[model samples]
Target: MALFSIQDICKSYPGVQAAQNVSFEIDEGEIVGFLGKNGAGKSTIIRILAGVEQPDSGTISMYEAPCTFTMAKQAADAGIAVVHQELNDVPLLTVAENMAMGLGYPKKAGILDRRALNARARAALAELHMDVDPNALVGELSVAERRMVMIARALLTDAKLIVLDEPTASLTEREIEELFAVIKRLKSQDVSFLYVSHRLKEITELCDRSLVMRDGHLVADVQMKEIDEDALVALIAGKRKESLTSKRAERTFGDEVLRVEGLDPFYRGSPFDLHVAAGEILGLAGLGGAGRTETIRQILGANPNLGVTCTLNGRNVQITSPKQAWDCGIGLVPEDRRNEGALLNFPITHNITLSSLKLRRSRNWLPFPSTGKEAREAEHQITTLNLKTPSAEESLANLSGGNQQKAILARSLSAGCKVLILDEPTHGVDVDAKTEIYSQIMRLAASGCAIILISSELPELIELADRFMVLSEGKLVASLNGEVSENELLKLCLTANSEMVA
Candidate 1:
């Protein structure tokens, strides 16, 4: 008998069929990888299995016995634990307190056992080869260090079936290796895992079996050895042949759109300077914390001035706020889209017209929105971008990740932006959506919109960028036009930080 089995699970929210007849099983000591694009029901199914939600119709069994439990106590009692993609550590609490919160620690006749709690927390950290002090506040740690704390928490549990949701999404390459090593150790101890991720390469290495989900249905279940990367993509996207648009000749190159000379934004980094031309596509390439985001924020008026001045269309201008930048025909699609770009609770129409409410304004007392105009614009953008939403009135949160991104792009375009800045435009997006986003960027450039592209993925920068610049230690170290070699860009970007140490 399998260790765990979920049969005929079905769940529906207001406008979303989160899961439909989703069935799967996992054997003890086996690692099963779940592959899906965003909104493919991966998280929903895992949540159900972890007892966070009760499915509308389903049967979850352990060892062929029907399992019924509440969300609170059942998860730990049933030996099911989850480590979310986002860290859940409390900033003000020490690592020991956070780790021992629900474990009923530091208690004897209502008295606290401080020494025992610290010792246990220290042991958990030590098991993972982490040397941080157990009494340190979580907020004092870095993103990677916080992730290690989460790992330690999960390991201390008696969890037999663990569901990891995008555990490596924000991890660096070396940290990912450490996590995989830990997983290997756990697998030897006969623990089962349901690993969810969009990274196909990691799936191949970490999973014994793989399951593919599409639109709330389990479409494919097979051994990891049976498929290649291309085949796996075809399975997920439901298409065999796909092509990215080739680079074309520039139709028009207007005057300088936004000029930044000697722009320096100080946030634990060196100073830098650059300019963006109208209808030009400028690419920023560097590893994390290389000041790419800092420079973009400075241009968008979100950074405190170290020493920066700007000119728009040959006229000197001052932009001290985001609204000022918007008035200057600049639109920013922020990296953290959920928090900064889109209003998650609002409908797609609201999100699409947020930056360009002028497009929907009609003749009426108090100047209310004209539904007719909003619908027309929404339909055009939806059809043009191939968004997969039932209607403009559907909540932005109801749409898939790719569709949400497309909606954000539509809003930026509708705002009449002469310059569009995108940070990690394809982050967390699938292959098909990546191609579509690149196409949209090209279309904007063709229509005389200067684009500033910032990305950590080198392949994406090379494939989509017209001209590339490398940032190292917050300094503009190199620039290349037409065709930039990957190796050359890497060498240039790493040289500045390398030189400082020498």
Candidate 2:
């Protein structure tokens, strides 16, 4: 018998049919990959299965028995656990307390037993081969570490079915390997898993079978061995070829468009100099904390005023603030879009026009919400980018992971920016969306928009960058153009930090 199954489930929200007759099943000891565009009912189905939300119609069964659950607690008692895309740890609480939420304190006095709680949390971490301190504040952890805590929480519950939504979204290679090892062990223990991810390579590696969803419909359910990346993409996108966006044109660089001279950030570091030419795609490659994002932020005036100076279009400029950088025709798509780029509560239509709302305002400097010009532009963006939202007026947070990313890119491009900086544009986006975004970036570069791309994925930089630079410990260590390889880039990033230490 199937472990758990949803049959012809349907759900609808105001102005959106979030899910329509969506159905899938998991088997014992199987890792099933769930693939879909953002807002294509992935979260809705997960919510229904987790008993966080009820479907408008249809039935769910557990072990061939009809089951009705109205709360997450009930689902947990039924051996189901869900790790959401965002961590739910309490910032003020220690790792142990946050991990043990809802479970009573191990003492009769009602005062928390810190030692026992710490020991349990430590044991969970040790099972995953992690060495984090259980007493550490949840807020003090990195994104990757916080995710590990979440996984540990689920493991402690001893749930039979685990749903992981973008589990490795913020994880490094080693962390991901550790997670896979844990998953493999659980599979052997007859604990089924529903793995949702945007990375196709990982899906193939980790999943036994895969299901693809589109616009709330289960489009395909097949074994992982039967599909290649291209076939999988076409299955999701509905065609092998589409006219939405194409690859960028190859072009020669013009004179220096941006120059950084003796740029010293807030930390103690040696000064460095680098230059970007007109229409050039400058790739900044480095490990997680090698200062690639910091360097770009400093150039775009998002960071504190660095001691060094920079030049834009041959004119010496002081970019002390983000507004100053904008005035100088520089735009940045920050690394953390959820925190820096999009307002989660706002509608897509509003967010798309936010950066350029000033352009549409009258002399009195008041926005005209009813003008419909911004609405038309939003629609244009939706069509041009092939965003899969019900409408632009829908809340941005309602969209799926990939569509939310597209909306962010649309907002950035709407600014009419000259020197554009895209940091990890494809982060958490699905394969179809990744290809579409790459094509869009290339087109932007071909239009004389000097581009600076900061990415940890070496193949991306190697594929799109005209010239690549490596940052190590807040300094530019190697800048190479033409015939660059991923091996060279990784080596530079690894050595850069140690070089600074020396």
Candidate 3:
């Protein structure tokens, strides 16, 4: 008998079927990969399983005995826990407190047991080889650290079936290996995992079998060894697709568009100098806390003016804030889209026009945005990017994770930025969406838009970037001109960080 099972699950929204007749089961100690494109009903099915949403009609069973969950707590009681792709963390709370959210507070003598909470949370983090302080505020942790914190919180529970959605979208090579080791160790104790990720490589590495969904339907289910990554892509896409690496072209670039000097004082050698050309894709490679995102943040003027000299298009400019960076023709698609990029309550029109509100005005002198102009501009980007949304009036929160990411990218496009910085731009998106995004990036580069891309996936860099800059602990370690193997790049980054830690 299967350990946990859901049969004929169905769900629907206003205009989307969401999920249709989805059926799957997980055996004891099994790790099943739930593979699907964004909005393909995977999230819906997971939500129903987590008891966040009730299926229109279906049966859930454990050990062949039927059960139903009407609330998230019910699912928790039944040993079902979900770590969603979009993190559910309280920024103001400490790491231990966040980890204790649903696990219940430890109490002794009618008072909160703070020491017990920290000890438990610290143990969980250590299992994943994370070095985060349990008493540190969640908001102060790096994005990768926050991701690990969420995973650790889920582990703190005594879950029988743990569903990890894009669990490694932010982790580095070292962290991912540590997590996989922990998962394998847990599996020996009969723990089951529903591993969800867009990185097919992880699916191949960690999952025993796979379930593929497309257009709200569970289209294919197969053993991992029986199907290759290309076949998996074909199944999820509902059509055969060319290999992404085959799309690579010769390195090309125009004039240098941006230049920076003295950004990092850690280098005792020559002063750190960085530059990206008008039509170049510069891939910034690093481990977590490796200063990949921080470098870009400094360029965008998020930190204090730290003796960092920046020159844009051959002219020196001072960027004092993110808005100032955008005003000066630099647009950023942040790594954490849910919290940093999107306005969940706002319409797609407003969100898309956020960075380039001036472009949506009826006239150049208009102080207020023109509604018609904004709608038209937003619609253009929606169509151009193939953003799957009901309408421009739809709230950004309502769309799937990939569509929300696309909308944020559209905002950068609307800004008509001269230099664009994409930090994990395709973090949680689907494979087809990844291809489209890659195409759009190449098109932008061809159109003379200087791109500084930060991707955790080394293959993406190998496939699209004209060059690569590896960072380790706020220091420049290596710079590869082109065509570097994934293992080689990973080794370069890992070796640097390992040496730094020592």
Candidate 4:
């Protein structure tokens, strides 16, 4: 008998049929890949399995016994644990407290035993080789560390199956390797995993069998060894899509539109100088903590203390704040879309026109937001970006992750930016969404917008970037033009104290 099984699961939300007769099974000690595009019923099924949502008609069986799970606690009692894409830890609490949540705290005679709790948290984290302090607040930990805590918490449960949703979206390459090692160790002990991710490479490397979903149905179930990356992409995308490398072509460059110099002095490294021409996409390549994000922050005036010189369109500009950067025709689609990009509570119209509210005003004298104009602009953006929404008035939180990302991109472009900075634009989106984003970016570049693309995926950078600037330990180590291989980029990212090139 299979360890866990879902048969004929059906779920619907308002006008959307999220899942339709979905069925799958995971054998004991197997890591199954759950592959699908955004809004393709993957999240719906996962939620149903976790008991966060109930299916209209379905049967879930564990160990060949029919199970009924109406709440998260019930699911947990049934030996099911889930680590969602959006973290569930309380930010104000310490690591130990967050881990002990839902699970009772260690207590003696109705008193909380702090020492015991800390010891347990430490033991749990140590199992994953996570070097986090139990007393450290969850808000203070980095994204990768926080993820480790979530995984550790899952392991602490009496769960036979763990569902990991986009577990490596925020992890660095080294951190990802460590996570894989931990997963392998758990699998040895007979823990099954339902690994959901948009990254085909991760699926290929880790999963034993792959299940593909599209349009609220299970489309394909194939053995890992029987399929390649191209086949996987085709399965998720419905039809065979062109390779990302096929989109590469000879890009035309224009006059210098943005320049950065002398940021390294504040970062305590060699001097940094760079220039981006109009209609050009400059790729910034580096590993985590390699100064790529810092460089972009300095250019956007997000790091005010960083003494950096910037020039726009041959004119020296002093950008001391994000507002100043916006006024200078610069906009950044930040890496953390949940925290920095979109207001989840707001409607799509508000998010799309948020950065350019001044342009939506009816008149200068009144100085009030014009709802009609905002809606019109939002509609245009929705059409242009292919944002899937019922209407502009729909809440941003209601849309899928890919649509939310596109809405954020619309906000960046709505301000009439001349130099657009996209940091991991397609970080959590699926293959189809990624292709759409790439096409939109290419169009933006062709229309005289200078773009700075920063991505941890070296293959994506190698395919899209016209020129590459590699950062290592807060320093610019290499600058190369034309096509480059992923191995060369990874080498540059790992190398320290390389000679700086102009």
The TM-score leader among the candidates is 3
Model 2 worst lDDT run, 10 consecutive residues: 241-250
Q: What lDDT, from 0 to 1, does candidate 2 have?
A: 0.80
Q: Arrange candidates, best TM-score first.
A: 3, 4, 2, 1
For model 2, residues 1-502, the per-residue Cα lDDT tens digits are: 8998889999998777888898778899999998887667787888888888999998888897888879888888888889887566797898888888855556637776788889899999988788889989988876668888998888888888999988887675557788999999999999999999877778889999998888789999989888787787777766783543343455777788888776654365677877888878999877655677667767766555455577999999888777788888888887667767888899998888888776656444564544476888789888877787777889998887768878888888777778888988877776556766787777777778889998766777788888887777666777787667778677878785544311
Enumerate residue pairs that collide in model 3: none
TM-score versus the correct structure, for each prediction: 0.84, 0.88, 0.94, 0.91
lDDT of each: 0.77, 0.80, 0.85, 0.85
Error of 3 at 216 (Å): 1.3
For model 4, give the 10-residue run with minimal summed lDDT.
263-272
Candidate 4 lDDT, 1-502, residue by residue in tens: 8999999999887777878998889999999999888778787788889998899999999988999899988889899899987788898999999999878899988999999999999998888777899999999886668888998899888689999988888677877887799889889999999999888889999999989988789999999999999988988888887765356566788999999888772367567787899999999988877778778878877666667889999998989887788888898998877777789989999999998888888886767779988889999888876677767888898887767888988888777689999988887787766766787788888889999999988887877789999988788889998877888778878887676554
- Report the lDDT of model 1 for residue 314: 80
- Residue 497 displacement (Å), model 3: 8.4
Clashing pairs in 2: 38-400, 39-400
Residue 255, model 1: lDDT of 78
2 versus 3: better TM-score goes to: 3
Off by over 4 Å in 3: 245-252, 265-271, 361-373, 497-502
